[model samples]
Target chain A: MTSPVLTVENLAKRFPTGRSGVFVNAVNGVDLTIAPGETLGMVGESGSGKSTIGRAVLRLTEPTEGKIIFDGRDITKIPEGQMRPLRRDMQMVFQDPWSALNPRMRIGDLIAEPMKLHLGLSKSERENKTVDLANRVHLRPEFLRRHSSDLSGGQLQRVCIARAIATNPKLIVLDEPTSSLDLSVRAEILDLLNEIREQTHAAMLFISHDLGTVKLISDRIVVLYLGSVVESARTDELFSNPAHPYSQSLLSAHLPADPAAKLERHVLKGEIPSPINLPSGCTFRTRCPVAKDFCEHEVPKPHHIGSAEHQANCLRIPDGGNRIAQTETA
Target chain B: MSLLEVENLRTHFISRDIDNQIRVAKALNDVSFRLEAGKVLGFVGETGAGKSLTAQSICGLLRPPARIVGGSVLFDGQDLIEMPQEELNALRGDQIAMVVQNPRTSLDPLTRIGDQLVRIHQAHTGGPVTASRGRALDMMQAVGIPDPANRSNAWPHELSGGMAQRVLIAMALMNNPKLLIADEPTTGLDVTVQAQILDLMKGLTERFGMAMIIITHDLGIVAHYSDEIAVMFAGTIVESGPVREVFAKPDHPYTRSLIASTPEKLQIGGGAKLGGQPPDLYNLPSGCPLRTRCTFAEDVCATPPTRKQIGGGHYSVCHFSGALPEGGGPQ
Candidate 1:
């Protein structure tokens, strides 16, 4: 297999609260690796620290501990000056395209800014590439002259994609890129992302709370709970037979768009606990429907389910007690 | 008789621009629907589609610059539109309760959760404080908030997003309302918490036999939760019917596109005919609002399309309703 484009080891990030010595444990020792041209989907609820991992991987936020190897380089602690050139190989697309882009600049200039800063291309070459990139993202050439405020949400996102691909980065982190869009518009954006992935062969860290979207686009999946990895597996294996209790519950909770689909719901009670004072042992034990007494004190190690690639962090897996009995709601 | 009947409802945003020219945004045009007790009606639409406006018009919640120009909202055989503000005020919180998005902002930051529930109950029911307090605790428990006795005293800021949403639902139930309107109630919540809250609300609605209208952008929630569904476009409901029938055989072009766009049904680069600018409410098209974005628009579509009934209680407002060839749009 080709070398992994991005590998994270024991990555952790904690934000200091108002009270001295108190910190919000956003990400806790998350270890993951994304192979070149592969899409790694990160699924979690709010306060799950999925976005933190994305930001920390790109060094947008400083990590408190652990390592990030991008394209075989340990750039976790690299200085900003040294990281500047490496930035060309890593790109990020945020949730809100409106705020991520500048209102003053024209659409063409916005798409061309990255190339100008990194590629050292002449004016004519940059202009030609900007037009080509616009067409690549299915954006009209006429829209290049218009300002961002004049474009719709879907068009603006296409512009953002155009900018991200302008650098042809090896690693791209997309944090809920389609969450803000309408249903139909979201499908279009997903299609564009899929096409770009096939053409550019860029490894992607697709972080989203929507299971359906993640399942549609990802080659592999990682489930996070309270800043920790709970399960990781191939997309089909994870969706068909999720081993972790949290993963099972989360998948059951997702209501499919089709009314005919049978709903076997295992509705979890209560919300995720505060990140500041996370529950000890299994962070998800508080809400896990099948949690046991041992789950209170002992953090479950990753237990491979069936295949080496499919693993879940749940102690009950050995005894076949991880599956929560789901009630048929349909 | 239906618990609520909204007929030919129209709401307009009449404002003056910087040039002092009067601009009227026909936000809600000829919208109509009905709801019986113990039933859930889902309003599904994109942003600026007048789903919330329909709810506001039903409850007489329209503010300045947004006026109800036409139509009647009848609740329990009485027209809410013609009713005086004093009478409407008494009926709003007591008989018709509403739970909106952003649970944190909807709450009164200064008041404790329990006290807020009690205050709302007292304002509507005019009971003794002790009884109100007792009912407040019962409601908190009813909505599945743990440790209601102590959690009641917790401030709004102390509660999490899901907890705050539960408190809002509890507040809406304090008076045993006949109709509940939840506008994007679970928009910002996680899927797990959203399931819990939706289950709680469904249980409450069945127990109390309260008619509910859940306005949301998520089709998944509507598909599973609602008995009937209404698909809205630029200020108009283009389709309405039983949820199962609508999902099984959608007659409107817009409805077809919406269903085809779902992650389960969508095939990448399969020509789903998705993505177009939302209709400009300020300068809406002459007839069909969706004509600009629709793939099968023809010269005849410039004229207004009349509602056609495809089956029992299944209606689609399009000139070519039920006649369009399957999967024959622009590819």
Candidate 2:
């Protein structure tokens, strides 16, 4: 088997609250791997710590605990100076494209900054490559001269993608890249990302709250609840037969684009609990439809469902009680 | 009879630019639609397409720098456009109700949840506070807020996002509004909570016999919840028709592109043209709003095109609406 491009083990992050010495346990123990050129989608609602995981994986936010191995190197506690050289192989595209980029810098310099800093490319070479990157990401060469405020959301996102791919990074973490753009423009961006995946063969950690968009691009899926991985499986398998109660509820909640499609909505009982004071055992128990007394006392371990690759963290899996019934009948 | 009939609604943002010159943005031009009671009409558009502006225009919620300069919003027998300030104020929270995105902001942080509900009823009907309180409790239960009697006293900040939205819906229902405008109602809620809220809305529209206009950019929510769909571009209804007809056979280029772009229908490498340049309200190009991005655009497109009806209430605002290429296939 080929070595994975990224591996995260026992990943956790605790954010310190003001003066109280109390912490918001944003992420719990999470383990996952992304192979070279593989797209792993991480889906969760707000406060699910999915975004925290993405940032922590890149060391943009320091991980309180866990190990993040990039390209077969354990860089968990690596110094900022040492990580600066390693930054060339890892890039991130932020959610709000407008705020992600520097407003003062022209698009040309924004896209060229990475290449210049990492590869030590000359001004002439960087200029030529900036145009090449722009064309590759479907951004017109003329817009490169404009500031971010002067461009549209889709165009600005393309510039963000251009910057991310400029250094030929091995891993790119996109945090809700398309969530901020319009629907039609989102499709165009997804198409561009798909094309780049083929050409660059970069492993992507596509983190989004929208399941439909994730299903469109991801090879595998990981569902998170209160920062812990509840289920991880092949995209097709997970969609067709989700083994976790949370996964089942999430899949059912997704409103399909087609009007005629029958929706069996399993609207969960309550809002997601606050992350500041998470649930004791199963963080999802408070909202899980089939949660029992045992669920409150036990942190269900990942149990292999049909195959080893498809696993769900639910004790009800063995008893066939994992699936939640469709309440919103057609 | 249609509960709400909006005709040639022209709303503009009359503002001054950074340079201090007066800039008039034609935000909504010739927007028209007829909605019957108990039916849901979904408005699908990108940002700045003026979905919320149209709602504001209909509800008389427009503030200075933005005004309804043309057309009429006739609700039932009376023309809302010409209505007096007092009459419009009385009608707003009663017959015409609006629930916007971010329920927390729409709610009064100072008032208790129950009082907020009762206050809407009292504001419109002017009944005894006791009667209003009784109705408020009933509405709290009606909108699916648990323990209506106790939850009534809960502070607005204490309620979760889903609970807050339900409270907003309950507040809208207190006066038994004839028309409800939910602008991006379930946007910020969790996916699961969104479904619950949408289902609640659907049931409420039927039970109360209200005409609902759901203004949202999510095609998925619109597809399932709405009976009719209006596709807006550059602040105009580019295409509109029954949901089934529009989804099955999109006529306008913009609508076609919209449906083709859905994750369910999009072909990965098909390279469907994304939206064109952002709508420039200040200096809109003459002719169709979508002309800038349309692949079928020609010299004839230089002339503004009127809405052409294909069949079954299906209408497209383009010279060659039905003749455009059918969307969604591996090309």
Q: Any idea how many clashes model 2 has?
A: 0
TM-score of each: 0.98, 0.97
Please estimate how well model 1 matches the true structure, expressed as its whole-model Cα lDDT: 0.93
Q: List the residue pairs that clash in candidate 2.
A: none
Error of 1 at B265 (Å): 1.2
lDDT of 1 by residue, A123-203 (tens): 999999999999999999999999999998889999999999999999999999999999989999999999999999999
Error of 2 at A323 (Å): 1.7
Off by over 4 Å in 2: A19-21, B16-22, B328-331
- Per-model CA lDDT versus the true structure: 0.93, 0.90
Model 2 chain A worst lDDT window (10 residues): A321-330
Quality class of the docking in candidate 2, CAPRI style: medium
Which 10 consecutive residues of model 1 chain B have the lowest summed lDDT? B322-331
